[model samples]
Target: MIHHAGLIAAFMDGGWRGALIQGPSGAGKSDLALRCLDSGFALVADDRVELWTSGGRLYGRAPETLAGRIEVRGIDVLPAPALAWARVSLCVRAGTPERIPEPAFTDDFGLRLPLLTLALLESSAPAKLSRALRHLGERR
Candidate 1:
């Protein structure tokens, strides 16, 4: 079940679950995902993600094509631990801009997941993402 277009995964809550970031190519998804992982977020999947909707709810997974793989520019693809496929809460779609500024928005499949878009150039994007995740959890 191919998710859609472009996406990356991040494991949070002690690997209990994860969030998926859906965006287009060259949107700096991997770079942002990597930064988030470096700041303690685990990589569930990068590149291709497989999604499924059941019981009027949405679920997602990493396709076998790009499971356990994280790409780094000018470097090899880093392997990640096995993920038990979790539900997605938030989807972040950021671009390569100057600064993160404030949290942005991302919505898909009729579900509005307030995505926190940040410019990849900003070194603090991951930190902001982490904070956004925490805020999301608290709000939910």
Candidate 2:
């Protein structure tokens, strides 16, 4: 397993795919993830995610002790709907998002996933992520 310093959340439309949210401490990784979960995505891991590659695809899972738990800032750690694992399709970096971000990708266990950069505190962050995933799906 590959240890990661970020949050992993999954969304299922016809199938499941995850987004690896990475950034510095207090960069709103968990906040954006919670927004995604609120928008119907499932939690794979929070704060720390364990990644692995299988059949050329990268997948993410929560460490045993952290499964089904998410720490909301200023609130106690809360139990949330979670997935044991998910195939990751994207990596969202929590930073300054461009009006049209230059194409980017992130590597996990030798597998590459599309990267979308965004400012997590923006009110439209969740909607923007959803849109990006949908656009990615159309290209697949």
Q: After superposition, which runs of candidate 1 have C-alpha atoms over 4 Å from their true positions?
A: 4-17, 55-57, 96-107
The residue-level lDDT of candidate 2 at 107 comes to 69
Cα lDDT tens digits for candidate 1, 21-130: 65667667778777767666666677777777676545676778777787786687778654646666666655554443564544566655556555654788777667
* TM-score of each prediction: 0.74, 0.89
Each model's backbone clash number: 0, 0
Candidate 1 weakest ten by summed lDDT = 4-13
User: What residue pairs clash in candidate 2, if any at all?
Assistant: none
Error of 1 at 114 (Å): 2.3
**Highest TM-score scorer:** 2
Per-residue alpha-carbon lDDT of candidate 2 for residues 104-139, written as tens digits (9 for 90 to 100): 776645866788888987879888887877676454
